[model samples]
Target: VFVCKKFLKKDGRKVRKAAKNEIMILKLVSHPNILQLIDTFETRKEYFIVQELATGGDVFDWILDQGNYTERDASNVIRQVLEAVAYLHSLNIVHRNLKLENLMYYTENNHNKVVLRDFYLSRFENGPITEPCGTPEYLAPEVVARHRYGRPVDCWAVGVIMYILLSGNPPFYDETEEENTDLHNRIIFCRIVAGDFEFDSPYWDDISPAAKELVCRLMEVDQMLRITAQDALYHEWIAGNGASEKNLKDGVCAQFEKNFAKAKWRVCIHSCSVNVRLNEVGNNSSRGILEEKPDEDQGLNVLLARNTTQQRYGPLKLFPSSVPAHCHSACPRRDPSTLPHFLSLDYTQMFKVACSTPFLLLICTSL
Candidate 1:
């Protein structure tokens, strides 16, 4: 099956430029771990990009309270991403954005290969290209400092990914007296630019020292000293016995559920293409996609095929007094465009649907 991504020309120059960039980058690489572009067509009002469909969910989908998870499992995931980055670097192509949200499994199976997706912010690096564009949490030091940067920026992001994968918490976060998205982002930026992060006592205690060393090397503040993806692929944790066999499910799940519980359509799993996989698993319940309209522009899959990054996304607020908490996952009146305003909901019911109740996996994303 294939996923056809649509971009309304009216979305403006930023969207058009991103579409152009994504097409160019997909055409330039042929790797097992990267998304491949198949065909492209454009109309006066829009552009359509038909690419191979990855039926598996994003990185977090496989790790959240997933059974039998371990440090070694996280290592395997990182190694695949490093291999993809290593290939991109060899061509001098820098993927400005690299995070858990952008990484997907080729299928929902336990042994599915990890595939790196999303390349709209990618560019061919002739030198230290300077441009501040990326998810706030995953931004590299040079990007935040507004310094000219190159491929090492991607490596720093890899470190952040590794850190999140191993500990279930972001390396840099806001803990000040005041709190809000804007302020939280600002404080996090300060921490990122200063390379202020820690393995915190309890989180790092059971984690292997070699794993910690690799995280530090990948996330080094000095871009010049950051470990390259090609080099990182050979790290002890990734290539040898550095990763411990100890199961990290308990601690990792606790933090992941708490930290990311607020983000709704914000996690970049925007492609409706993932819905096809859900249907295959007989997930026809209220928490599933509810219906399937695979034709382009027909269902949730095609509507969110555009650049639905975190910047355009906000936390899932759930139902308000106006809307009932018992509503189905795919309410008929619920259009993708109007879903964001409907985010306010019953917090208790939402968690029950998400955690022990049924893992309320709302793959729904909004702009």
Candidate 2:
């Protein structure tokens, strides 16, 4: 079955514009690692776009099911993403949002290719883009600083993705951001603008040096020095034998669950209904949240992955909205230990688990 998305015209001028732009981008590109568009329809009040569906689920769920995961595996995943980004770069397009939530698997097999999704925020870079939009932790230094930027931002996001894939922790998070959010957001921005992040001891101990070097280059404070997606494809960590074979499943997964499972700052603060979706849970179906009510007649609206799994989805934001990076976090200069230890919030006001949805209905309205 194909997935159909309904974009309401009344959502406002910006949303309407974004929906049209997304449709154009989806129609312009086709790669084995990117979602494919099938058809489109426009009504007087809404636009309906249909696309191929993924039954496998997303990268997060795939990671949870793996008994053995290594730096090499992470490298392979990153390489595919870079290849896709390189292809897009050749076309002068930029996927502004490139977080873990956007990567999915193609099937339920033991081995599958990862695919990239959610291009509503992606844009064709005709010139320097000045808008600061995207997930906070993944925003490039130039974007955080409100400076002109373009495609390197995606490479920077790839660096953030690689960091989480290897360590299970966000490179730029401040444990204390939960208490004083606005102040912390200011602090996080300052740190990001300064290119202040670290490969802390225990986490980086087993990680390969070449991999670390690549992360640094991708997240270079100066966008001018940042590695392009095409160049990054040749990095030793991605091309050579720089990734370690040591199984990092326990440590990395524990951190992944710890970091992503927390109720996000906006989720906790916003007084809105969150459509929570669980990926690949016991069926060839995808799981996700949407603002719309569950209606059997509605059919499928969004497809997360092609992998079928009994394990459920990865961090539940694969079809997340374009969140402008105004999040809070602690200053990076403070000793990580000194920040108040953050407690994981069980899915309460913001999150709900899905039971059985053949396809994810992920429609979020930004507040």
Please, what is the TM-score per model?
0.72, 0.72
Compose the digit string of candidate 2's lDDT tens values, residues 121-166: 7889999986656665687877655468999999999999999899
Candidate 1 per-residue C-alpha lDDT over 150-249 given as tens digits, one digit per residue, 9 for 90 to 100: 9998999899999988888989876773434445555666678778999897887899999999999999999888999999999999999999999888
Question: Worst 10-residue stretch by lDDT in candidate 2?
Answer: 324-333
CA RMSD (A), model 1: 15.5
Candidate of highest lDDT: 1
TM-score, model 1 to reference:
0.72
Q: List the residue pairs that clash in candidate 1.
A: 272-301, 317-343, 317-344, 318-343, 318-344, 318-345, 319-344, 319-345, 353-360, 354-360
Error of 2 at 90 (Å): 0.7
Evaluated at residue 121, the lDDT of candidate 2 is: 76
